[model samples]
Target: MFDGFTPEHLALLRGAGVPAAWPRGGVLMRQGEPADRAVLIETGVVKIVSESANGYVSLLALRGVHDLIGEFGCLDDTVRSASVVAMRPVHGFVIAAPRFCALMEENGPLALAILRSVINRLRHADDQRAALGSSTAVVRVAQVLLELSERHGTPAPRWAPKARHLKLTQQELASAAGTSRESVVRTLRELHQRELVETARGAIVVLDPEGLEWWEPEGD
Candidate 1:
């Protein structure tokens, strides 16, 4: 979405918002809350989740730098459908709903970009649902890791040469993969044993991305 904006348009969007920051574990927005504003994430990651009536929380997606959240609510004039929690310390800007909607109305290209982004998200949701129904736990976990690496990974430090780090927790990964935490633990243990990844307290380092791509369960 940001890539589609012209410099002037980007400046306008940024200028409309006030600067804000959130510590790790902060709730930027909550489900069922009034849709009053949209957040433009300038740094760090956040998780979007929805809680069911039975108290089950489902991870819907992850948003990082340059991502705009809460726009769906703003667009539809409805309450927030999910919660946005900071996965790490986050810095961003908050644009009030009216301003955001006005900007969209006045800017054709920007509106189109946001529309495309929404369509892409819907498509991704559909694909995720299909995978959850058809793919094995191993496949789902691997896919989630690969997505994190591709979308948000940073190269590992000098001490971990040729590796890449993903800043996400095991529980979060399990939620995204639609599996149990124990299952993710077992799968990650297998991955570690195969030297495909290294896990720490709140991060996973990919030691062999290519290998992970080709990895399958031993008996598969």
Candidate 2:
């Protein structure tokens, strides 16, 4: 909900508690559904997926805690541009297409909110771009650590890269950093030795982001 919704809009959504749910691996939506409105996460996680030519599920993004699913679809009706699947048990608020349109029409400020959000995200992507452009694996890893420091460290977008939507597997990291899994593993092992990062609960936790960034390998 916006800071204020018109009374008419409020009345319309009185009973419209999207009340949606998804289990892990549940398909929230397919790739070709009629694109209308977007979904808001009330709880749990959602994954925006991309598929391979042979039809394997590839994780494109992961959204958690108040993230919007398919907002682009809501703005303009078209074929669904991507697939959304539940990464964990999820519940959301589904803003229907017409209602969403009404919101934009009634609230000029809402439009501004959208634009600001997009700009902020763009800045984060630019940071990640700089991170990848780094000349060495240490730098790349440090950049990722910086990102995580912002995520799990300071937990703020301005202080960290905004990639809450990214669900990076080792394969995805390989694709992002242009390296093999073995290389990633080797680097990770080195980082582990220095206690700069630790693997836990299916994700990497940055221990000493400063130390990780400061310690450059002999060649790198």
Candidate 3:
């Protein structure tokens, strides 16, 4: 979201925030916690998850470098709506709520950029909700795979130049697709048989992303 910011603007933000590092699986922000600060991700990926009283958890979004987390709670002065967990080793800066508000007020361009980012997030949420309501489990899983590849997958440097790998567990994929782990496993098996994706212990490599995109669910 800070992609539009100038070097001076980024420097100003970094100066006003405290640098922090998180190992994979660390919880950056917890649901229901007070919104004390917002994190600006400098590197790595994080997953936003929402948990219910019944102990069910859902993956709401995957955020990567240059994204800002916890801004919604800070902007509204409410408790965090979802939990943010590090999907990989993460490096970022934490800006206190008051300082963040002050910085936005002092910088019109920064405020505008943040507003646009928030709008985009809302639209994405709407799209996800619609897909969850209407799409089949196979379609949902495929959609999540495509989204993850586009958002967080790392590109191959030399070998298999056009392929990308997603560092996600089957459980995480199930959560993101809003389906049972068995269902995701079944869908993945079908994809695997087609030579579209290869799944290992805790990761999936997209060998034929275009094939995944063109795949049709049963009865579709």
Candidate 4:
């Protein structure tokens, strides 16, 4: 979905006649690869992630329809700075970078909205970095839960989901949160004993949101 798509913008997309479907996984785009094209989603989700020299991966963004990826590299005349992978099957409308720039130049209103969306995402990433680096693991996990809740949370007017749709394993969670599985498991157990979380077969659910955030221990 568009973070800032308007009815007028939808009209513009239709008028421009962008394609209705584009899909790829695995190596959707590679680091240092030329920015040959930019894509806008029409369906499904894609992840923008970067691999470090040590082979650690950091998730950058999750994009749905109307969220543009690789546009920055294309605009800056540089190679792609990161890789994009399809989390699931994706359908997108793709255009060469030069053409997208030309279209944006001609279509001022839609261009402005897209630019704003990109800027907002960068700002959010910066804030997330700050929070994760300075906060405790409990705080970090709490934030992740809130994020998953927003994107994959149920829509039944419930306080939160009984289970999250995070497609990450415990090791992955530990890496992202800068902690260990034992510690994470311990924290989960502590929360569980207090009836603040419920464990399913492979997933965990947050019961008392504030309690999870309040779980910071000494020297943690």
TM-scores of the candidates in the order shown: 0.91, 0.70, 0.91, 0.75
Best of the two (3, 4) by lDDT: 3
Summarize candidate 1's per-residue lDDT along 6-106 as a digit string, tens digits: 56655777998999999999999999999999998889989899999999888888889878899999988999899999988999999999999999999
Off by over 4 Å in 3: 1-9, 156-159
In terms of lDDT, model 4 sits at 0.65
Colliding pairs, model 3: none
Model 4 spans > 4 angstroms off: 1-3, 11-25, 153-164, 175-183, 190-220
Evaluate candidate 4 by giving its C-alpha RMSD to the native, one decimal. 4.1
Q: What are the per-residue Cα lDDT tens digits for candidate 2 across 100-199?
A: 7676677676556655555666676687777677657646655664554443232223323432222345554444455666776777788779766655
Q: For residues 119-150, write the lDDT of model 3, one tens digit per residue.
A: 88887788888977798888899989987987
**Residue-wise C-alpha lDDT for candidate 4, range 1-220, written one tens digit per residue:** 2367787865565444456453445556788889987776667766677788998776566666666677787778888888888765677666677777787899898788878877887787788888888877766765665575446433332435443444444554555566767766776676667766665544456666566556554455
lDDT values for all models: 0.86, 0.61, 0.86, 0.65
Which segments of candidate 2 are over 4 A away from where they belong? 1-17, 54-59, 145-168, 176-178, 213-215
